[model samples]
Target: MTGTPLLKVRDLSVGLETGGGMRPIISDIGFDLAPREILGIIGASGAGKTVLSRALVNWIDPPLKVTSGSVVYKSQNILDLPAQKLRMLRREIAYVGANPAGALDPTLPVGQQIVEKLRAVAPEIAHEEARKRVIDLLGAVRIPSPQMRYHEYPSQFSGGMMQRALIVDALVSNPAFLVADNVTQPLDVTVAAQVLRLMRELTTRFDTAIVFISSSLPLVSDAADQILVLAEGRVVERQATKALVDTPEHPYTRELISQIPKIWTSEAVAIDLPAETRKPIISIRDATRSYRVRKRGTFASYSTVRAVRNVTFDVFPGENFGIVGESGCGKSTLMRLLSRLERPDSGQVLCDGQDITRLSGKGLLKFRRDFQLVLQDPFNSLPPRTAIGAIIEEPLKTHGIARGAELRDRVLSVMREVGLPGTLYDELPLGLSAGQRQRVNVARAMVLEPKVLIMDETLSSLDQTEQFKLLKLFEQLQAQHGLTYVYISHDLAMVRRVCNRVAVMYLGEVVEIADNSRLFFDPGHPYTKALLSAVPTLEERRYKPEECLLEGEPPSPIDLPPGCSFASRCPNAFGRCHKQSPVLTARGNKDLAACFLVENTLSHAAA
Candidate 1:
């Protein structure tokens, strides 16, 4: 709501040139970014939100071309600018992407990379000054011990930290306009909240306009002042954030809102286990895992990172057990232990009361056939060159279970179960959409008829509608196959919808374990409470600074304190919490929490 618009887009249309001829990807998308204002773009995957963002900055790569558009900034049309001038114009317009790992340079130290980017934009700035600015930018992103972390490479940083670093890199030049394209999609809820909060603050402080593109309607609704709904590469509706959420007019917008999984309470749904399958199918008894990481300063010295520390839990047959936590919280490591991909450093992982942690040769192969893993990134997880049929058939062929016509029939059958069309079996994964690729992943895992399925953030990358469809498919598959699921995700709401029981992990240990309703409604651990509070709702887009806000980043797993892993960030942390690590103890009816406060409350109730 200012004098001059920061950026303006008019009659923008993008098209892809293929063997079949030119096909329109985005059509006549027009919008304005006013100074210090955020314009949120909400759309499902393949709706052309990403293409529209690329077109704004004139970075539409290969095979795709912007046929018609005018990006007006600083009283000039950027599309009409010369190559040299266009490059200069790009310095004042920045873009941050969703995948931090792909965006960063692994060879260079993260801080050095930031300095190099800054110098590229402003060559006049000295190296010493650029380094200082990089440190300041890192601090602004809430990265703890910026100076020390500056020397570390991208591999050392967690997913959340890397995303923040990418943000720091994007803002180094203090651009007049910023394009954040689904930047928080891959991040954990708490980290996403932190990054979004930082972005809002930095944009406001610097008086920068931003175009925030996201598939999650609630996320964009909470982060931006105005929301633009896009469907089939066209703008369907545009309105203020609150108005759009409260009374969405467009059918597409309304549908997007309806698909979001809400936090469930006990009364909302029955979360009971089947009577015959009450016995634990998979059990973890004091399981621990550690990795030796080489020290930065000393070549010979190394530190042991306790990735999974005394993690103990049970997965009942035919029940969905959810593991929720931030990045580097040992969720994936624990999955590895359960799947027998990696043996635990200590203790045992029992399958039907038999330890399978050290199973080898024929036994290991049989165990692998009984358990399968679904990874997070569907596009990357699937091979680009291979056809969908081959990818799904590989699992069956590897185990020597099927071949020839039988193999093709099995793949197609599973594909139908996951809602993938049989016609696309011969098509490569590169041509399919994100949702379809994930369906293929599900089909591939289910082809082997596994008894246990471990989904590690499998649906996090998809749009709300796609996620909803996949969640339904998961339930159907579970019922049909009698599969036990260990769902690992940072999405608390999705976990609530899909899981019967939930375990909240912090750093590298389980902080709380309870039924879905109890975990969401009456979280016993402070860390769990903070995580739930950080989730964005339809009514509220941003986390309140005062309500259960974690004060600082988690401590490094390599040099963890002797006490509780979450003690540093726990709101109710006490002297005992900092001195002694609490074990999971009964807090409520069938609920367990590793917290001194919960123990005290239980004792008081008994007294």
Candidate 2:
């Protein structure tokens, strides 16, 4: 559209070679990307977005082949290049994928892995220079203490940190063009916001071009200069970001836009319960959990990670209570504490007036029947070799709840309840869609007839279409069974749509807790405000991202500071914030905030 394009595509198509014949996965796609511009490709899962990304870099493997057309980068058609030329071309073209956990080798240090990649792509570069570049890029991505983090393994990094490290890995070579495929999908809102801002800054600083791919339309609209919508292996719409969102010509584009959850509007769904009249089904009083891990590159030296510290909350019966935070804020550890998977080092976890921390033997089994934990990953959570029916029935058999035909009937009953057809009962989970597998997961939990369910980022991995359906199912199940849910997630939009009450955590502490309407509209703690500002939405933001979004990762849990953990990043932090920690105190009718600013205001008001 402007001066000589950096990359040009015309009539590109990709096909999967099947036994029946070749079937098209991407058909007749075309676009032009200029230097320093960002193009976003958005669609639901299985819309051939990944296939198109792979084809752009010529990374297509066996059973997948380019059926037609050309992808010309700098006047050379990449689709027609040989292996040797392609290998050399990679130095100027980089691709960063969605799943950072599996990208790097767990056995090697993260920085070492990145440096090795750099040396492989550009063998002429010296090892020292490559290492220095990787470290600098890591710092550029705002990973705290890059010099120390460089020696840490992949397992030692949290989800957000690992994702940022992967970006450094991609940019260390100074590639002119990048293909980032759903890089922020696994991150919490704040971390995702940080990553998007970093990408925008990189395009200006490095003069690089990018093709950002994701399922969420709002996320893409935030970062992309232009958007290309794909549906059923074809480009459905391509226009400037604001123009397309404000007035779309295609029906598919409109449908995708409709699926995004509303955050700051009257249409957003919320649960309003009379929580005061009911007792807490599960209550945590001053619960604290910690662990000891070996120091980086040290065999004997160890340090303590205070994963959850002085956390306390209560979930009223039949209420959807939400726990929201970024990665490494101890959401998972607190979930484990609530489910009794790991007992806290101190404090009490009570269930229906009974201390659940001390449950053992049959008592523990009974507790299991009363409470169920649904995990995040849909692929690895269930056994690959086991049949779906047998997987669901294992819990029944283990608890001795039923036998023979009775167990079979109960399993089918729940399978139907969760909208999973009975035909797949005998089939292994080999090729089931992510949503269907998650349905199996829900069926497994529902079959136990638990009164309370702890969902830990349960819907994070699925596309918005699937998440919406599952949320409706959860609501129907709750109404029929009178159930209570404790949702642990980094997805603030989803939490806003479903939860009656929401809690914000930072550096292993409860920074704020309030009703859903209050938390989103009038957050008290700076960290809570930061989380709200970072949520990706099409509506005008209640909290401006530039004013409240945090700048860097949370402080290390291994050696937390004596004062407020959030002080280092707080924009309004004063002298006292760096000297003394604050406790959760009353803010309004039922809201709580842990901030000296709020404490001072309340004191002044009383006087």
1-607 per-residue lDDT for model 2 (tens digits): 3577799989999999999999999999999999889999998888999999989998888799999989999889998899999889888999988777588899999999999999999999999999898888787776767888998999889777898899888888878999999888888888788778878887898888999999888899999999999998999999999999999989999988787888888544555566477888888999999999887668999999899999998889888999998888899899999999899999999998779999899999999999999998899899999999999999999999999999999999999999999998899999898899999999999999999999999999888888989999999999899889999999999999989899999878999999888888888899998888988998899899889988865677887877899998999899998899999989987899999999989989999
Q: What is the TM-score of each candidate against the true structure?
A: 0.96, 0.97
TM-score of 1: 0.96
Candidate whose TM-score is highest: 2
TM-score of 2: 0.97
Model 1: per-residue Cα lDDT over 312-367, one tens digit each: 88888888999999877889889888888889999999987779977888888888
| Top lDDT prediction, candidate number | 2
| Model 2 worst lDDT run, 10 consecutive residues | 266-275
C-alpha displacement of 534 in model 1, angstroms? 0.8
